[model samples]
Target chain A: MALPVHASPLERIWHYAYLVICALIFVFLVAPILVVIPLSFNAEPYFTFTDKMLSLDPAGYSLRWYDSLLTFGMLAPDAPRDGAWYADMWRNAAWVKAAKNSIIVGFWATLLATVLGTLAALGLSRPDMPWRRAIMAILISPMIVPIIIIATGMFFFYSNPCSILGFECGRLTSTYTGIVLAHTILGIPFVIITVTATLVGFDQSLNRAAASLGASPRRTFFRITLPLILPGVISGALFAFVTSFDEVVAVLFLAGADQQTIPRQMWNGIREQISPAILAVATILVVISIGLLTTVELLRRRSERLRGMTPR
Target chain B: MADLTAAAPLTTADGRPLKEALARAQRRAKTRAFLLVAPLLLFVIVSFVIPIAQMLHRSVYHDGFSANAPAVSAWFAANPPGTPPDEAAFAALAEDFRAMKAAKTAGEAGTRVNYTLPESRSLFTKTARDADRLAPPYRDAFLAVDPKWADPEVWQAMRSSSSAYTSDFYLSATDFRHTADGGIERVEPRQRIYVYLYIKTFVLSGVITLLCLILAFPVAHLLATLPMAKANLLMILVLLPFWTSLLVRTTSWMVLLQGQGVVNETLLSLGLITDSGRLRLINNQTGTIIVMTHVLLPFMILPLYSVMRVIPPSYVRAARSLGASSWTAFRRVYLPLTLPGIGAGALLVFILAVGYYITPALVGGADGQLFSNMIQFHMSKSNWSLAAALSAMLLAGVLLLYWLYDRLIGIDNLKLG
Candidate 1:
């Protein structure tokens, strides 16, 4: 709200103080995250800036921490820089392997979540869908429930998925399949939320018109509905991917040593050794999140525009 | 025409009855819609709901004792509680001890009973190891191995655990233990943890929720009142942290708040405090609160901003014009109007904060741990029953709030960016 000209001096002073307070809060919100980026490059194995860094000396900055990300688990970390060294890093570096596992699990989990969640969102958004509220709650309850509870439950159930059925089977724990299944459950709510948000602005009449024009339901979805909602679906998919990518508790409970994702590795790194390498990883992850956030924002604006709604 | 149609159901042009056709079509549409959602629904139920239900079952049931000591369990079943150590009971214990020794499950049985009767696990294993030396006077024989066998409380524990299921874990979770007389009593003062942690979890969560609101309100108001473009740009300040990885945020906090970290360093150079007076910020209660508030602040701001943005600034103007001071106008008009947002944000943050594990686990040292950390501890220790019980309690509290949330805010209105 704009300050009125008739406002008293105390009111004007309070307004200025309020703005300053808001600015400080904003700094509190953002400064900690922004603080890590520069510190990640500190020449020393320290969490703070050195005098050289304060003075803007080139010697104060180093890529050693980022370099350690590649060389930490490499079998021949000290080998000369060559093709074999790069291959060793790709194959054996702890962070690289963890990143690979994260991508694999995130990709499969997002795929499954997007497909199943989109279908459910479409159904839930329909007027004739039965038991809509109850079903919607069940679908998204994973998000509301604490990750520890969900992880604990999955830890027990996945260990013996058939235990409740009075039978024995192979355990799902410590397996990629189990991790993917858990991540999918965690990601499904985001997909449902984003996709259904888009569906809210959908014009069902277009689908009806396509049907009246003798287009089959599948044909109509592929041709008319899919094109209009692709942005939403993609947005939902990205959300699901991010959810899977960022998940750690489930990985901690369900993953084996071989299934270490980036978060899992970072968790171990943080707990066992608070190295600058972790800060380096955190910086890279921060950049990735910024990119993802920007992408989602763009997609959201495009979705609004495609639906013929004015962008906020 | 009406009379004719009443006698013969209304027919389409092709002479088919329209009523049956329409009913069948409607049924098909309903089925189709259900089929679309069926896969995900089933997936969630199997992967999510059933596992939680199974965990709840574990909370009340552990078969470690019942499955191993079949003869003793059966004897306890035939006899009622408060039954003294009769000859038959001692003989059954001897028999089960022999079986346990053979099956190498004395440790298992004792572990189960130890959950209720502390230190009895060693007695079970110790007696089971020397079962071969037992004589016909079984009561004396068992007592000779360990005088604790004469304690009725041990018998009560075994009796309660006689079946494959028992509520002992739940009882213990609420800080009560079974007495020798077959009644529940609070555990020793020194041993009580779960209830204290629960209260602390809620109180701390309440405090954190309040802190988040205080920090968030001004920013949310600023953002909501600002022009759209500037608000969106400033919103990045909020969204970046929201989008950043949780572990990263936690790590950054650790860096900033650690004793030798930036904050302390700055404070030290400024003479804010002497070297020895450096704040014990990380790995304590204050660290837990600060990190959690920062993490959950976005949750509060988004909802408050959304609500304030649509409040039709005229409401406050109306109040101001009616001889109300700016402060009075805000208090009377703006504050009350934002109540819904306050309630939603507070409940959401509290619910989330109550269940927070990773943040408190990482930043919270010994005294800073929450209820969820206790759950994680039990899980890691392979104490599945206790973990499940603690989880069930946490889940109950969460579900109640969730129900409150659904009733108040409507789950459909739950939004994320």
Candidate 2:
């Protein structure tokens, strides 16, 4: 806020000092994220910036770290950048496999969470919904409870997946289905919250009007409700996807070698070796999240507009 | 009765009783709503709820001794507490030992008892192998095999272990044990790490929460008081971190905070310290606190900003006009108005921090490990029972805070940006 016109110089000084403090806080928030981008380009293995780098020497910086992420696990590092090379990189490179698995898991988990969570949100957002408060609490608990606890619980439960039914349905632990299932539970809360928030501004009278015009419930949802809430649904799906993609604890517990995700690979890398390849991955993830964040923000603004909620 | 009641019932426009018609319609609506939610409710129950319930059940479901050592278990059941082991008890023990030896199950059985009584695992295995050669007057024979058989503590453990369902895991979780005389007693002080970790978890979480609130208050206040466009631009600073992968942020902290890294390098060049005197910021509690505070700051800022935005600035101005100083006006008017936000943000951060695993696992050295790290240790040891007990305790605290958060600032108000 602008300082009030006052006689004392102290108040104006404090106002300028306050602005400076805010600037520092913003720097604190952004500095770490920016620091990694430069480090990932360092020619040397060290994390520190070289003296040459500070002197504006181009030789101090290179794309080797990013390139290493590709060729580290490749069968032939010196080969031409051909289709076979890319295919081999995908097959052999640990990070590439992790990226692939992350996409696969993120997609499936998002699909499951969005469908189930959206339907449930529709029900919970209804005026006539029963036990609404309690159900909302239960559905959102996966977000509040610690990941370690959830991972441990899933470890025990997935280890003996068939014991409850008194049959040998085999173990879920270390399986793709198990990891996807755990991620789905973890992702549901975001989906429910976003979709339900969207549903809150929805008008029930539209559904009534559609029904009065003889449209079926399913038809009315597609024509009147689904299109209107599409932005919310997409945003929720993005959230669910990110939750699954960023998650490592569940992958650590539920998934095996076959289901390794990017975060899990990073966990191993950071624990065993703090290489610049991880910095490369971190930089890439930051860029991806920037893209996702922009999409969600745009979708949110569109949703508000569709709902006619412009600022008064 | 139906005919008589139907004749006198309040009628509707469609000729059905109004009460019946309304009740039927309401019932149908409830069913429809429930039907829409049932699939997800069931999915969550199977995926999340049931697993947690099963894990908690392990706290009382240790059946190792009772299930394996049937003979010893039976003798413990037959004799009363504080009973001296005589011939029959010794004979049952001898028989059980022989049976365990043949089945090669003595190791598993020993591990179970050793969970409570340390260094007794080898005793069971050693005694089991020698049980076949021991003579009668079974007490002396058993004593000759292993002197621990005569110790009252062994018998006490046996008696307690007779039941398949026992609170031994919970007792061990709290660093307590059931004594031979059936009285509870504290464990050896050296072995009491879980309780220490739990307390440290609480204290650290509180410190983190307080730090977050202190740091977040000013930023949130600025965001609230600024113009919408400026605030929205600044809001990206908060939201970017919120949306970034947690591992990425933690790795960035590692890159910056490690010794010989940017922070230390900057300090060294600035004549802040000698090369040998560079601070050990990484892989320790300091690193943990700093990184976690950064990561969780958004959680604190968002809720506080949301609450602070709605608080009218005129409240402070009105107080100032009444001749109060700026500090006094802020304290009485602005600060009081932001209490709910503080509660929400503080509780949210505290809950998340208390259960933190990954950050501490990465940056936290041996000394910096939190309660979740200990739980991870127990889990890796295949000590699922102990882990479950620890998890149950952690879960209780989180659920309580969660309920409080819901009660004070409803879950519907939880926002990401």
Candidate 3:
């Protein structure tokens, strides 16, 4: 395609203005995160960069914090060799445990929500499904309801021991199962919405073609339908993962001290202590989130391309 | 021809009525679709809908008064045209109070009454002890224990409980109702909360939505119009923060904006001030707005960028070729074309902002707190009814805005994908 030429000086000025504003925003958006990344490497255990660093001194460069984080008394099976450092690390152990809980909760919630949500999307997208719009609206209600309300409801419902199909499960409040279930409830909507969007352009004809070629329904789905929808499934799963990982308010009421997730840990850290180790964790989290999101974006684009819904 | 005709009927088999021999197949397909959706539907109903319904029910739930105090109800039911028949009814109330005070679950009842009328505790206790006495003077003494009871104010409150449901919390949320004294009044001026908070929430959400658009528009434009490779790179950069925990992002803002943090440090180093700037970035309205705008920008950008991506470049080129200045072309043509995106982004950002709790709580001072904070407060205090009432108001507000936006812009037409 031939590129359009610029027309007027006013247009040129407008373009430059647009570019300048965008550049400024990009800096504003990225600056704090970038600042944290380097500060994570600071030899000093404070927010400030040291004088040595200001003067380009090599002594300022130390991986002590990183080493401290990994071997931090929080993770140590025994007390640290250094007593003071061990106490400090032990003080931070709640945060480490919370972060660990966050990973487990995020993974399971994401996996379950994505699988269930994808199935829901497929079922809803089928032309013959009755009350598709109503079903979708119901599925998406969790996304619309305020988190506090959801938290309150979950608190009440799970505080009492409830039985399902004669299987007596005790009160779920303060349990890992409770938090994961709550997180999945929150995560599933995002997966459903995104996957449904992906499914909108999916070709039923391909599945029909496979079926006509004497493929079993299960085999056709696995070989043809699943592959075409893989990108959607991945993106949906990533969205679910991010949603669960970042969730806090619902978990706040549902999770006990033992079940505290990373966000809750960070919440306490911010409220109680102004530790730079949190900055380190924040930087690490930002990196991981960016990586995951980029992959999601790529998957989204690939899904669109695979469905031939948009130009590559 | 015969083979093809037979195959046509075979194809029709796919669409055959379930009433015929295909009943089993139709039932199986229906069962499969239901099975596929049953788990999520079950989860939402059990986890989301039923709990919310129960919360809503709690708002009007006078079980504390009705279920626990059946004697009180019976006394009212037995008392006929008022000869002040009189001492017997008082005796019955006293008996009910004695039972209520002595009951193991009395505390729960007291707590519930405390939410509505905190002073009811002493009344119940006094009535109980007085009613337990076996004398006429005792009955007169009980009546005198709180003269307010004879004034019909207390009687009215008690009588209003004839129905099992009450709208007291909802009325309180709106700040207009009759006091127990039968005085049609507003809540105490100082206790006159919720209305203002609701207004502030709406205004704050509106401000944040506008700010996101202002901040996101240029960036979204650049991302939409840049060279393909560069645009994708910039888009990723824009979305990068979104993948991180919202709590972490909000906290990071707190860290950066604190008095001794990097922003102030950079300013100090630049000789902007002799000391770190005392901007009071955390725990203020400015901080809330700034953090919220940043957090919600991705929501704005994605929709706007998606919408912008679909507008063919040829329209702008053609307008430019027709002697239209770039500003004119954009303002008159391009901007109008991008309205769908703007609408979608605005609706998404506004709705999210209204319901947001953590960002404002972390960054907002007392003056900056939104309605969601009150919702949290009520929930924690075990005032589920009032919490539900407040949430119902919020949900109504959000839905109204959405309805208005849909009416104004046709949200269905603004699909980003």
Candidate 4:
């Protein structure tokens, strides 16, 4: 907005100061992430920049910490760089195993959340859907409720799946099933929200028209509705994937010794030691989030176009 | 119409009554839609809802000692409070302790009582060890084994804990317990922790919310006023933090704020403080506040930005043209319009911050611990009842706020980056 002609000089000074304030906050937001990248490359073990590091000396940087991530939990880290070393890392490096666990948990959790959430969103979008507001609230409660409460609840629920039911189903805690189930619960709300937002602009008349043309409901869904909502579903799936990938609380409560995920590993590392390896991991996560962000952004635009939300 | 339908039997082209055919179609549609959602709904109920409900149930559910020491439990069931420990009560306890000792279940029995009376685990095990040596007039035998058995408070605690249901854990969660005479009483000063943690959680989260609101308002205003391309570019700064792994951001804070880390080192080089005087920032309240503010700031900025982006600038300009000073114009016109965003952002931040676990766990040392940390502590110790009680209170507060948020800004409007 332009300054009024009658504005006081005091107001003008305040305006410039306000701009400075905003700029500083922007730095506050981004500088932490920026600060970690260079430190991860530091040849020194210190978190701060070394004298040579500030002087831009070549010897001040190294990839040794990244090497440590490979050998952090390896059965034999000092071995030569060969098949045995790689195999030891594959089987035993804590971070490597964590990464694998993160993938498996994220994949299954996302698949469950996306499939269930998408179907529910489809139902929720229908005009004739029963108890719409109440059902929506129930589905979305996992997102709103405090995560610690949820984790505590899962801790109990998984302790004895047979506690309430007559039949015995064995314990769910400290198992892949428990962590995956917990992540799936946490991821459902995101999928429901994203998919439902896309579904808001859907035309119901198309379904009726297909029915009038003698198309079965399943065929009509696959041929028309699924195609139209594919972008939304994909984005929703990605959202679910990210939610599961970034999750740590449930994993903390439910995952067993071998089920440690990356976040859990990072939690241990950050707590026990602030190694440059953690920074290396943080750098990779930052990069992964950037990719996820870009993909979600693109899919959002496509979904908007499919729903005719934006003019051509 | 009724007479006509009766006479003509109103039918569709398919030769069925119109109402019946339409009703059948509607029922089929409803069932089909319901069938699609049924699997997930059932899954959520089984996995999420029931767990939460059961956890709350566990808060008031105390069957540990009752289930373990059935004879003593039956004595309490047979005789109410104020009933002196005659032969039957003492004999029942003696028999139960003997069985527990023989079965090696005295530890569980002790743990159950220890929850009510701290440092009393050894008492159970000790009494169980001496149970066989006791003669008749068993009260003296019990008293000779341990003076704690002579205290009516122990009996009161036992009587209350004997039942399957008791409010002792909830009372303990709120920093209260049963007295000798069966009246609820304040716990000792040394024993009071949960209340302090709750207070600290609320106060710090309140401060964080207020800080976020003050900091985020101007940035959101600038973004809303700027050109689309510039605003979107600037928005990335906010969105990037939102998308980043929470641990990464927390790690960055740890790196910057730890002793001898970036901030302290820089200050040290600048002679701001000596090596010994480098700020104790990490693993304390300061670290928790700084990092949480950094992490949750995006949540505050997003809602404020979304709401601010819609308000026409003309209103403020029009107020300015009416001879209102800039401060007066903003206060009277601009601030009021953004109140919805302010409320939403504050509540959202507060709700999330209050339940915070990972950041506080990583950075918050002793003085900065929250209620959730206490829950985690008890959970790991297998103190399920106490953890459940704490969780019940937390879940209640969060649910209330959630309902408010849903009512004020429909859940459908909940947006993620």
Candidate 5:
């Protein structure tokens, strides 16, 4: 790809122009996301950069938005800075409650998706698996199908859980179980994808060798296969967690006021009114995603190295 | 081969034929593999597949008119098409009106009929309120109560809606209406939205996919041609956005594109235009296209880069060495090699954009809205049947593209990094 010295002036100009075009495209890709990181620190109650802020005046920046994230829904905002004040903030802040709900729902959904998806991936990766293509398509369809469709269908189906069985039962809507199940379905494709990919590089003979050495099937799985595939499983679990954390449409349809997750809360905020507090929340989520992305990337590298696909 | 065919089939140690034994072993393996996947398969069927099926079923099935207007339904069943209403038909209608009045289900029956005949729900309720006064001359008495009921179109609508399951919703969804003579015709232009919106959704998605491909091509090419360390450094810029929360990215666009937002401010300060000429970017089609192209650019870039990275630079060089011009080598040698990536990325982006809801909801006000937003609008209005029908249409379109993607580029090759 290096430019040749024997090339003509026209070719040299084209090469430089191509690089400049690429640089602008990269800026287009990254700038909007990075813009919010600084705007979240704006002292004035605006989404744009004030002149002072742009000029790098120290007085133009503040932690007011981050502070508002704590006090917006609390019982008292002017209370003294004490343990009770902190307790009150944690107890009643709307954002705090949303973060809690997001974590709880994400954890259970990730656990369920990872376990079920890992098992299914193992079955699918087996050479003698029956109807693999069709089954894989079915499993991955929750991802391919539009979220709005899934949300609407879940709305009706969850409204009456037992009606499909020709009986009466309680509703799953507005409950933790319903949200978890919906998110799990949404998260399964990622799990299946990542784990199955990891298994592609797996050496199946290890399990056979363990079995041949008088180890039971269960022992072989726990002692050899699980250990080898743990990185993929963890990465899949992280992906599932993030998917649930970021999901909004399903939550909007299924969650009641008491079960509001972060995205749901942010949706209400943006629709009702845009506040700097939302930007604060967005900033924190960006940080979290950065952390999760790093983890997954490192694990990917570790898995590749472990499988001897990369040199040390 | 003839000798082998003549010989007896080879046997295993236990005297079973080898072919039978081998087949049995393979069958057992397949069953075991299937067993491992059965729990998830059943879970998905119950939680995902069944719910979607039920939603689709709701599009064609509503028991409101059939269950509540039993007498009229029975009379219609006894009679055939083109049957003029007689004394018995009027008597049956009066009986059903009385029954519906007793049950307080006039509204439900009216709502079901309202799908095909607008404002007919009020007709049912209005008639049922005066059902107690109707005399034996039921046909004349009904005409006196509501002169509109004398219309043949009313009778046609009622007859069509008498069944528990009908295709009226699908007809209405596609902007066609049932005629007075029992034939289908297009609704008036003023009322036709779904078909137009469907077309708009597909066309807008196509434009966005094309924009994404244009924006992503050079960047992907650069990444593919760069040295490894440099490419990885630039890759972070792409992956960071891919991993960011969708809401976060969408909110950034909102902040950037709003009228008083940064983009306008920057343009205003730069004297690009008068302050009055600030672009109406947000809450319009331009905003939707711009934001979506940004959001989906990564999808195009990743696939293109993955495809391009494996392409040998030697081919293009050899073309140049053999006296082919740079443009000629690129057009003939490189472009064809990248076609698969283009197809995959375009289909993926187009499918996602077609069903996109959140971005359009926030920024795509009235004229910019897609088909999914219309479905949501119906759902919020509690018009479940129309919403279900629209969703079914969207789902069908998406699944077709998905199947196409699977055929052209195997689903197993779908990558995320």
Candidate 6:
């Protein structure tokens, strides 16, 4: 069918207005992130313009901060002499540890939640499943409940007299395991939600066809169902990874000095000190996030194509 | 259903009835599902439910006063002639105090006193110190030291402490109370807090939701209707923030918004204003709103865009063909179709925003602090019961608002896709 174009004068004006509003909103959404890209190249220590002022000086484009971020670590190489921005950031060892912890925790938690959540989604999506709606709601409660409550409960329950196999559980408070477990709990809902969304478009007959052709259930899932759902699973994993990576409040209660995540580190950095290194880290994260999201979009498209649900 | 059941095997491996076999299989499936979900269920029960129960229990659990002053409670209850034989009460109270002092643990006694008296710290210490020196008329001396101790209310608090229970903290948090003094009183006006913070949280959440909707709607529209390749590109860009750590996103805003940040520098370079005119963006209400909007915008867009994508363009085209102007066409035909998405996105953003702690905690100045900040403070302070109460309040508020939204707009029909 030919595209209809009722471009009356009033319609044209409205279209222009809509475009203008949308462009402005897009800028508003992107401005903060875009601002970082240029500032990372700023020669000045300050978040603002350099001494070159209105003049575009080559000297204004030094990479000292980036250099320091890569080599000097988050801690200062020397003692605090003058209150230089880079030195102040490097002085906080906790910030560095937290960042590292966030990566480690995010990676493992994402892996675990994705695998388990995808499996759970498959099991729950079975036609024979009873109380599916109620079960779905129950599974999603962790996402709905306030983190403070969860954190507080985690603090108490993970501390002295921890339960294990109906016995006294060892103290897990302030431990890496505690933080990861907390993050995994938080991550599961995202995995479940995303995977379930993908599964809704899934053609069960593909699996049934494979099964009837003498393929085992396990083989059918691995060879047929797995490949079809891989994109959704990967996207869900990415989301779970991001969720764990970004988590802060729960980590505050559950993590100790050694277990601090990147967000917790950033929090302490902002609250205790302000420095350029944090900006560098933020820039890096923004880039990584953009990259991961692109992958998610790619995978989502692949999944849609696999299911014949949408055009690629 | 009957045919399907008939097609399946009617007996177990041992040739038991089909019903038995089906029941056994059903039980196995139940077991399997339970096993699959057990870790999460166990985690929630232990980490989410029990601690909250403990906190709720502690809100009413008071053992300090009554347990510590058994003789005092008994004497007060008896109201025996002439201060109830000061020697007997004093000796018994002195012995109990000595044991508490020797243990060097506040134990139940400390909890009891803390429950009744908000400032029980020094009182407990002072009382513990004098326990060893009690000779003869200890009751009189104790009463003399703190005349408020003679009140029936204090004695009743001591008596009630036999069981570990009191709603004092919740009362205090809410700024209302039936005091041990047998008077219904408001918590001291100066000490009263949190309620205002709770209201401020709701207001802040509402504002953020409105801001997100305003900012996300057009972007979502553009994303939904754009050419496929471009739309996919834009959608990825929109979802980019979701992939990053929230801390990183908020911190990026801080770097961009702070006094010396890029925004100020640009304005300075542009000669928009003098040095002092660099926008005061970070650590204020404005900064909090700006950062929160940035962090929450994706949530609003994703849902709205997903819903918008499925809405056929023909409806709006038909409206325009029927002589409706473009704006009228969109408003009359497009907007209603998108309402479900809008409502869903709004609910998601608002619910998430209400519980938001990190962004506000980082960017919000004193004036911008939300109720979650207090909840964090209480949790860190090891005041589990009060923290639980605050969380319970927040959860209730979320549920109530959700119920209201469902009632008003029909949440079941609000689809994100």
Q: For residue B108, what is the lDDT in candidate 6?
A: 50
Give a tens-digit lDDT track for model 3, residues A44-147: 87676778877878788677665544444354535556876566565666656677898899899988898888888788777666666567767876776778
Comparing 1 with 4 on DockQ, the higher-scoring candidate is 1
Query: Could you give the CAPRI-style class of model 5?
Result: medium
CA deviation > 4 Å runs, candidate 5: B1-9
lDDT of 2 by residue, B1-417 (tens): 889876787789779978889999998999899999999999999989999898889878887778779987888877778888888888888888888888888887777787777677899889878868977888889878777788888888777877878888889999998787889999889988889889998998888888888788889999999998888888888889988999999999999998878999999999998899999998888988989999999999999999999998899889988999888998888898999999889988998998999999999998788988888999998888888899999999899999998999999888777
Return the number of clashes found in candidate 3.
Answer: 0
The full ranking of all candidates by lDDT, starting with the best, is 1, 5, 2, 4, 3, 6
lDDT of 6 by residue, B1-417 (tens): 899877876666788887877888897877665555556555556655565566555556655665665655566566632242346655666667777788765445755555555555566567777666666576676765566555655544454444445666676678775565455588777767878788888898999999999989888888888888888777656766666667777767888787877778778878996797778888888988889988889889988988898999889878977989666987889999999789888988898788877888889987777777888888767666677667778878876765655555543233222
Score residue B395 of candidate 6 by CA lDDT.
Answer: 74
For model 1, the local distance difference test gives 0.92
lDDT of 3 at B221: 78
Question: Which 10 residues in a row give candidate 2 chain B its minimum summed lDDT?
Answer: B111-120
Computed on C-alpha atoms, the DockQ of candidate 6 is 0.43
Query: Predictions ranked by DockQ, top down?
Result: 1, 2, 5, 4, 3, 6
Ranking by TM-score: 1, 5, 2, 4, 3, 6
The whole-model lDDT of each prediction reads 0.92, 0.89, 0.75, 0.87, 0.91, 0.72
Clashes of each: 0, 0, 0, 0, 0, 15
TM-score of the first chain in candidate 6 relative to the native first chain: 0.86
Better of 1 and 4 by TM-score: 1
Candidate that beats the other on DockQ, 2 or 4, i.e. the better one: 2
Pick the winner on lDDT between candidates 3 and 5: 5
Give the TM-score (0 to 1) of chain B in model 6: 0.82
Q: Can you give the lDDT of residue A86 in candidate 3?
A: 62
Candidate 4 lDDT, B43-144, residue by residue in tens = 999999999998999889877789889998998888877887777898888888878878888888777778888888898888878867877788888889
Q: B181 in model 4: Cα distance from truth in Å?
A: 1.3
The Cα error of candidate 2 at residue B291, in Å, is: 0.8
lDDT of 6 at A63: 70
* TM-score of candidate 1 relative to the true fold: 0.97
